[model samples]
Target: MTTTPARRRALVVRGGWDGHKPVEATDMFVPFLEDSGFDVRIEDSNAVYADREEMDRTDLIVQCVTMSEISPEALAGLIGAVERGTGLAGWHGGIADSYRNSSDYLQLIGGQFVTHPARHPDQREGGEADNFLCYTVDVTDLGRTHEIMSGVEDFTLRTEQYWVLTDDLNDVLATTTHPVQPYHPWHRPVTTPAVWTRAWGKGRVFVATPGHSLPVLRDTSVRTIIERGMLWASRTASE
Candidate 1:
């Protein structure tokens, strides 16, 4: 008799300003996680961390959180879970730019979204703005060989070029440069890490820069990269 494999579990927490596309983006990732054999739990409330036991058992944590202050207990729980080998993956500012007041969150997540020298990174800065700019993404040394980026193609995104400050230890997968910075208050030419990864304890991190728009996630290259990240980040659980 064949026994069914234990089902992998994932939790998604999302909420913030409407402009971050929180609801819409969270909806998009649900099907993907479900397709990947995850019993997905999409939580509109950030209080999912109230249960430390639940967080401990999760195979992956896909969060769309942005611009909020996560309590210390919640932050510690998340870090501890990942360190115990629960994969952590997300895209854009939703996960990366989340927990604004928590430097501990930023450190655990590997990087933060600082400035978008172009139009707003999500193009919702002024509202009703849809004009786009295209730029090339360069794959770096650690980028080319990582499983998360194994089959990803370096493609351009017709969206806000994110300017991020990343640590030297991060496995940077892709980068894009913005020449429009001269018009802004920031004086230097900006080069953002379009994609990157770093380990938080025993768990792996997979992050992408293309989730700024719902439609942009439709890009063949963007979807491919995100898909790979989910699986790659979840490596510990699968093993």
Candidate 2:
């Protein structure tokens, strides 16, 4: 008798601050995942993390929660699931900036969004700003060979270039430089990772920092990179 291959499962947990357009961003990729042969489950609550059984069976988790609090039980379940081999992938503050109070979450993701410097008249010593700027994302030599960056090339984007606090463990794929501006304190260009991957136990972790809005996310190169990253993170055979 012939048998069909079981489709991989993906859980997308979205919703924190609406400013990130979690619904819109997640919506952009849901059909892609479904078309790529994944059984996709969408959730707006972090409570999904508390369901250990569900997490255990999931092949990948794409989260877009920004600056939200995750309960201890839910946090533990999320962490444990990734550590035990379920993939985790996200972009912008959704993953990097989410759960600011959870150190375990930070360590798992390998980075945290600290600030996105902007040109403002009254910018104080250490104040944050939301100004957008034009920058180029250069794919690293290592990235050139990585599956997630296969067809991606160096490209320019106008968005909030995130300045993140990162760990050495990340396998950086692409990077961008923050040029010195009058409103900024730094005198020289500061290079930051634009896309990267790291491992949490047997699971893979992928992050792309340029998805600040749907337009940015829809950029040809940006969209391609994210789609590839998602597949790579899930360890998809076709990736």
Best by lDDT: 2
TM-scores of the models, in the given order?
0.89, 0.93
Q: Kindly give the stretch of ten consecutive residues in candidate 2 with the minimal lDDT sum.
A: 122-131
List the global CA lDDT of all models.
0.77, 0.89
Model 2 Cα shift for residue 8 (angstroms): 1.0
lDDT of 2 at 163: 92
Candidate 1 CA-lDDT value: 0.77
lDDT of 1 by residue, 1-239 (tens): 99877778988888876666888887877888888788988887767775789987788888777777677777888888888888888888887788778888778878888865555455546553433567777777777787767766677777766777778768889888877543456666567788988887889888886677788877788877887888778745345
What lDDT is reached at residue 12 by model 2? 97
167-229 in candidate 2: lDDT tens per residue?
799999999888888777898998989899998887899999988889999999989998988
Local lDDT at 107 for model 2: 93
lDDT of 2: 0.89
How far off is model 2, as Cα RMSD?
A: 3.0
lDDT at residue 217 of model 2 (Cα atoms): 92
